[model samples]
Target: MNYEEARAYLDSRVSYEKRGMPESTELRLDRMVTLLEAIGSPHADFPIIHVAGTKGKGTTSTMIASMLTGTGRKVALHTSPHFERVEERAVISGEPIPGDRFTRLVEEIASVVEEIDAKLAPDQPGLTFFEITIALAMLYFSREQVDAAVVEVGMGGRLDSTNVVIPVVSVITSISFDHTNRLGNTLAAIAREKAGIIKTGRPVVSGVVKEEPASVIREVCRHLHAPLREAGPDFVDQYHSKGLAGGRVEVSTWRRSWPPLDVALPGRHQGANIALAAATCDTLEELGWTLPTEQLKQGLRLCRVPGRIETIRRHPLVITDVAHNEASASALVAAIPSRPEIPPSSPSPPRVLIFGSSVDKDWRAMLAILLPHFSHAILARYVAHGRAVEPSTMVEDASRAGIPVLTAETPARAWEEALRLAGTTEEPQEPASSDLDVAPLPDEPMICITGSFFLVAEMRTMMPLAEASVRPISS
Candidate 1:
């Protein structure tokens, strides 16, 4: 099969990412286990670091993989929701899987998938897109003889396809109210699903500091006899400063204390993720891996996750981030340069917010947090996926948030609208009161494209030199 054919084969299966999870579909790891058994149990060939969380798991996973690679180890990093290409989900030593290799792997797995489909029980669901992808990644990593694989859970940890592997260390980042319908609504309930990755006698690195979630992780660890390394108490990250370039943070663990280091990813929230990655590396060292301090520092300085506060353009300062929910939106708002507080009497509009989100997300709450940071918002639907919340549905939310809103048919059109708005500026008028806080605006206005990964992906395609960029994929 060629690349296109492989894509078609994968797309034909049931994908919860494209279509919202159906109540009729029962999520279980049995199907994944059966498939792996039929394929010679490739997941057992290497050590794994399983990561699950609501927000920062992907970043944390990438950081771990990059650091390991910096130590001259061949590491396999598997993440979900590709932005541009499907191969982005599987990375070996900082490079995406080649198209030809991906196609051949899909062809190899096709027959096994059919064989399993034929023997399934009547009520059992067939292999899903996520399950197949995980199997393929495992098979490829085994074939390549990777030293370690960092697998980021696609969803909740208990039944996620990636959960089949026995990881050396399980990492759970912060937990919040994302996917509340599937994973329980409360923090404790959600923490239960995330803590499912903690195995018997294995060590766990948890970034959850909230009492409700942290307590859940602690109980699970205690019951399983697993070592627990809580973020606030065991390891900590202190934020130094943030800029358009990146943020500086100082990380401290039981093993050592590191000076303030520049994190490639933006946002002060990444301070926690960096600390988690550092602590995980410390655990790996305890597990008999040689990771030098300099190499770890190099990995942290050079690592980049494309869509997380990525600046695609210089003029007008177009930034794209996948901040789909309330916590992420709040972080994005805080990470970006502080907006000049416009007085009520000012006529010119402030910075532009180009946004979209999925139907399952708490978009109303997200808007409440995001709208206050921008004077105008251009709403659009991402065409790559079917779960986008309608632009019209959010009109009232924007109005209630006291921000003027405009709707576009698609993400591309939204970009057009944003550029048009950013290009025009009214003469600067003196404030009615001298007491008002007024920060000077740059010569080029700023535009932020965010909300959903699909929206960010679509906007990314419109950026200059986009094809030559890192070519990000999503979950």
Candidate 2:
């Protein structure tokens, strides 16, 4: 099958990321196991670094893979919820699987997938889009003889398809409230779900600092006899400074201290992620992996995750981040360049926001956190996804928060409106009663497009040629 045909085959399956997740009772791992067994269990061919958390899992996974690659070992990195292409979910040595190779891989596995589908029991669910993708990634990595693979759990760890592998070192980043309906709402409950990746006698590196969740992870580690390396007590990261460009951080562990490292991803929260990646590397070293300190620093400095306060344009700086939850939204807000000081005579440059979110997310709470930082917001729905929350549904919330709002049918239209407003030189005005009041447009305004991955992906496709050519920094 060709590339388009392969994409169609995968898209035809049940996808929780595209459609909303079903009840937690319906989640099962038997199908994933059966599918892997039929395909020779490729996940067992290499050492794996399994990562799971509510936030920063992708960044942590990328950092670990880059560090492994910097040591001259072939590494495979698999992440989910692709921004532009499905191939982004699978990478070998810093490059996405080529289109022809992806097509061939899918074709090779197509018969087995069909056979598995044909034998499902009445109560059993079919293979999902996520499961297929994880299988394909493992198969590709095994075929290439990768030294290691860093796999990010698609969601909560216990039932996630990526959890099948017993990793060399399991890394759990900051735990926060996300997918609360599927995972439990309390911190301890969520921590238990995320801690499911901790295997017997394996070491774990965690960034959870809160006692409620940290205690859960600790208890699990104790019961399983897994070595636990907590963030605050085992290792620490210090945030030196931040700017629109990026941030500077220094990480220290019991093994050694590294010089201050420059990170391409911004946000004070990234300090914790960097520390988690460093500590995971340390644990890998303890497991007899050869990773020089300088090479580790090179990986930390070069690794970058797209859509994490990523600046796509310069003049009137335009940023896009996939911040769907309150914790991530708070981080995105904190990372935005603080309003510049202006003379008493000049008005502060307006901060324009283009926002959208999924139906299951707490969009109102997100808007409450984000709207205050901007002069006004342009709301739109992500056209490609069916789970987008209606833009009109958020108008009352924005009005209640005393922020002007404008609605658009699609993300492209929202960008157009933001550019039109940004180009205008108008004085700030008092809040008006109408819902569509976009009155205050200032000269040389900065824009932030955020709220959902789908929205950010759509906005990214509309970027000018110059901005679109800027690649993410990694190995």
Candidate 3:
């Protein structure tokens, strides 16, 4: 079987992330367990770093993997909700597995996956796309004999398929109210599901700061006898400053202190993520893994998370961030350059937003945080996954909230309209026409494209040669 055929088969299965997981039903881990056992339990072959949280887990996982690889060890990284292609979820030493190898791994597991599906109980759904994908990652890691693997939890941790591995150190980035319908409605409740990744005697590092969620995590760690290291009190990061490019900060942990660090990912919150990565590396040291301090610093400086607050253009300042929830929306809001911050003598560029969101997100809440900051918003739908909330629905919500919002049939239209509307003093700019005559604004405006990862993926196609790194496109 070829890569295209393998992807087609995987896409045919149900996806819990795109379609919400069944409410109030226990996630069926039996299928994943059976499939793994039949495939020789490849996850047991290497040490694993399991990461879970409402947000920032992907960044933290990528950071840890980069550190491990910097020490000259072959590392495997498994993350979820890929921006552009399915292969982005499974990568080795910063490169995705080869197409031929990905295809072969899928073919190797196809028989076992089908056998497990046939034996599922009547009310239960069979193995999901995420489960099969993670199984494939573990099998590939075993085949390559990686020194370590960093696995990010798909959603809530207790029943997540990636939870099958008992990691050397489990890291939870931050607990927030996302996927509330499936995870929980309250902070403490959501933290409980996240805390499920903590195993007995395994050290756990958490970046959760709020008292409610932190309390839940503490309780879970106590019950499981897992050593707990909190981020703020145990390993603190002093954020000196930040910009659209990245930030500078100093990370101090219980083990030792490192000089000021440069993180390539934008947003001030990444300082805390860097701290989490540093703390996890300290834990790995206790486990007898040797990562020199210089190597860890090298990894922190060179790491670049692709779509999180990614700047794709400079002239009009086009940026794409995959911040889909209210908490993350606030982070994106904080990262944007405010007009007031510019010296009064200098011209401040107006911020214009092009937005799209999934059906399951708190779009109203997210808009509440993001809209007021932008001069105006161009609302659009991400149709790539068929999961976006309708653009018309966003228009109504923005109207009810007394915000200026314009509708676009698609993300590309929204991008064009934002470019056209930026720096204009006009009230409520209309949708753009192909040949509309308008003068460029005297000062360039910053255009932010955000809402869902799917939207970012679509925007990537429209980026110019200098804007994006060239890579193989999955057909």
Candidate 4:
């Protein structure tokens, strides 16, 4: 009936994220379906928006919830992989579930969870950590009488516990190569798993652009007779600008067009994410939700996700982004100032990158995508439930990529070394340039710490004044 007890109960359950999905456990909806049925099917009490994809699901979900909440509706947003605390997974009206309330809910559900587990066979692991989390979110939203709930798939969609909900609109963000072992190897294969969220007669919005994956989604929509709205020609996001500060884009849907909107998240790819959220809202509009352009713009301007090109410091700039896979890694690199091709001609400040990755991730592809952009790289192991790829493996990857790298004992040490390397100015400086043609002295050398969410969370804890939860900064 307290935070510690709740945490201990959750920690004891089978966590697929911590211990990679096992062959012994079956991935199916039967358990969740039964569990919800036993608990009175709380998810059916309210309308839901189901989101699934390899990336951008969290951002898109947050944007939709923000807009709904801004319109004076009580919204529930459920996401995964909490950066600081477990309570982050279930938020109502832009606020985390209160500790006392969470404790009461945990106590309330313990009996049902025990009853279900007791009925399962000895060899079967019935309910997982993720499933319990989903149950808790649904129960809480139903109890609170929320107007709507935004549920993000914890992983690949088909068998994900959150799939138990029949959403009013299903949104699938960009699909890429991630969790290949669990999902599948080819894009088409991955798209098949992601498309499982589509339901008969439910409107589906897809942001997947790869030809193969797009084709798969189209076929699934056609077969299911789900109304499909693609992001390319049907919904458009025209890029305006992108930088560490933020990004700007003009999003257009069939219903309406908005002027250049400020996306608090950095990177041009976020333009696509914003467009996806817009399309989702437009779908809700058809479902009879009152969402005006002013409210939509307010929500877009107010939504900011931390650890995604998040700036923690200004002087001797220190940035932290969670770019674990190859696709996200490329986006992170594009956000940073790259080294000029002609060394001295259009010189950028010295770049130092501090990196770490999961043992199961595509290190070779990620390293090849990111290492060349930095002048110096520091590699280290991150502390997390899953093991980090060893520095030796990183060394080999960097060597094959023809880039020099320095190793550290831990992420904290890597941060320290990055600061030391970034501050060092050994090269003799050219005489202060009075010529206007010469770009005025570039800002101090940049330090970018990325590669894993654990690394960013750890680094944020070390920085002064860094809070566990982050929201958009009002300019």
Give the per-residue lDDT of model 3 (tens digit) for 1-475: 8889999989988897677666656576777788899999999999999999988999899888887787888888999988767888888888888889989998888888888888878877778899899998889999899989999998899878787888999999999899888888999999999998999999999999999999999999999999999987899998755566578879999888978887666788888888999999988888898889887777766776777887665556667889999889999988766654556788667677888988888989998888888777888887776678889888877765455679998876887787677643332222232111122234657788888888878876776523222221110
User: Order of candidates by lDDT, top first?
Assistant: 2, 1, 3, 4
Candidate 1 deviant stretches above 4 angstroms: 341-349, 424-441, 465-475
Candidate 4 has an lDDT of 0.79
Of the candidates shown, which would achieve the greatest TM-score relative to the real structure?
A: 2
Compared with the true structure, the alpha-carbon lDDT of candidate 3 equals 0.81
TM-score of each: 0.93, 0.94, 0.91, 0.91
Local accuracy of candidate 2 as per-residue lDDT tens digits, 254-362: 7888788777677899889888988998898899988888877787667767888876665466778999999999999898876666788998776789999999998
Instruction: Give the residue spans of candidate 4 off by over 4 A.
Output: 340-348, 424-441, 465-469, 472-475
Model 3 residue runs over 4 Å out of place are 24-26, 340-350, 400-403, 423-442, 465-475
lDDT of 1 at 369: 88
- lDDT per residue as tens, model 1, 376-451: 8998999977899899998988888677799998976887788788874332222321211122254447788889
For model 4, residues 1-475, the per-residue Cα lDDT tens digits are 6789998898889988777675524887888887788778999999999999998888888888887777777889999877777788888877778888788888887889999999888978858888888888888899999999999998889878888889999999989999898889999999999999999989999999889999999999999999999988689998765555577888889888877788657778888988998888888889888887776777777776778877655445667888888899888888665554444665556678888888778878887888788778888877766567777677876776555689986877887787677775232132211221122236557678888877777777777522312653221
Position 255, candidate 4: lDDT:
80
Instruction: List the lowest-lDDT window of 10 residues for candidate 2.
Output: 430-439
Residue 415, model 2, lDDT: 82
